[model samples]
Target: MATRFLIEGRVQGVGYRNWLQEEARRRGLRGTVRNLSDGRVEAVIIGSYEETDAMLAACRKGPPLAKVSGIGLDPIDDPDVSGFIVLRDY
Candidate 1:
């Protein structure tokens, strides 16, 4: 399964992208994460049901410096991603 996550609040410049890459890799998931121009963090994640669910849970807290205020989830059919990447800001 694949999904997109829009993480808001204190996410930018907080190591959230690196944290996401590490978390997804640790969970054996594939995806990409980037800092959005609107000061949010966007992540495209692909994995099994359990892993994706776990990933969402982890994203809620993010890295130590991140103060996640909210998260928006959007289910998608794109699964072309591989490994986990911390993409350049978008």
Candidate 2:
């Protein structure tokens, strides 16, 4: 399964992408994470339902520097990536 997460609040410039990369990879998920122009962080995660849900929970809290106010989630087609990565800003 695959999912997209739009993470809001103090996400940019706070190592959110890198943090997500670590979290996703650690959970054996494959996909990408990037910064959005509108001050949010976007992550595309591909994994089992359990892994994806775990990642979402982690994202809600985010890194210590991130003050995540919320996260918007949507189901998406899997990108078929091999490993988790952090993408450049959009």
Candidate 3:
């Protein structure tokens, strides 16, 4: 299973997606992170419960450049996602 996260606040242009991808990969998590049209960053991380929880915690603080205001999470149905990547903005 995957968890989709919508991160709000000062996300764009701050290397948020790149930071997220690096973190996910470092934790052996599989997923993709992208910038949303609404100026938020969105990520779908597929990994174990523990890894997922840790990723969410890091997202709250984001990169040193980001001022994360909020992060909303939703359980996803995808179970085949592989590798971490920084995707183009939506």
Candidate 4:
């Protein structure tokens, strides 16, 4: 199963996506993370249940500059994603 997350708070301009990319890679996850115009960071990570859980845990703290306030999870029907990328700002 694929898991998508919408993280709201002080996420943009804080290297949150970049940090997430690194951490996701470290955990061998496949997905993308991007910034939303509504001042949120969104990510879709496809991996084992344990790895996805770890990714969510990391998202709670985020980078040193990020002040994460909330995280919303949604399970998607799509197949596992490919590589991880920092998508263009939305």
lDDT of each: 0.90, 0.90, 0.90, 0.90
Cα RMSD (Å) per model?
Answer: 0.9, 0.7, 1.0, 1.1
What shift in Å separates residue 22 of candidate 4 from its native position after superposition?
0.4
Between candidates 1 and 4, the one scoring higher on TM-score is 1
Tens digit of per-residue lDDT, candidate 4, span 1-90: 589999999999988999999999988889989999899999998988898998999999999999999999999875556788888989
Under the 3 Å rule for N, CA and C atoms, how many clashes does model 2 have?
Answer: 0
Give the range of the ten consecutive residues with the poorest summed lDDT in model 3.
78-87
Question: lDDT for model 2, on a 0 to 1 scale?
Answer: 0.90
Candidate 2 lDDT for residue 18? 89
Q: Which window of 10 residues has the lowest lDDT sum in candidate 4?
A: 77-86
Clashing pairs in 2: none
Q: Residue 30 deviation, candidate 3, in Å?
A: 0.2
Better of 2 and 3 by lDDT: 3
User: Per-residue error at 55 for model 4, in Å?
Assistant: 0.6
Once superposed on the true structure, which residue ranges of model 1 sit more than 4 Å away at CA? none
After superposition, which runs of candidate 2 have C-alpha atoms over 4 Å from their true positions? none
Question: How many residue pairs clash in all the candidates, one count each?
Answer: 0, 0, 0, 0
lDDT of 1 by residue, 1-90 (tens): 899999999998778888888889988999888988999999999988888898999999989999999999999997687699888886
Worst ten in a row by lDDT for model 1 = 78-87
Superposition error at 25 for model 3 (Å) = 0.5
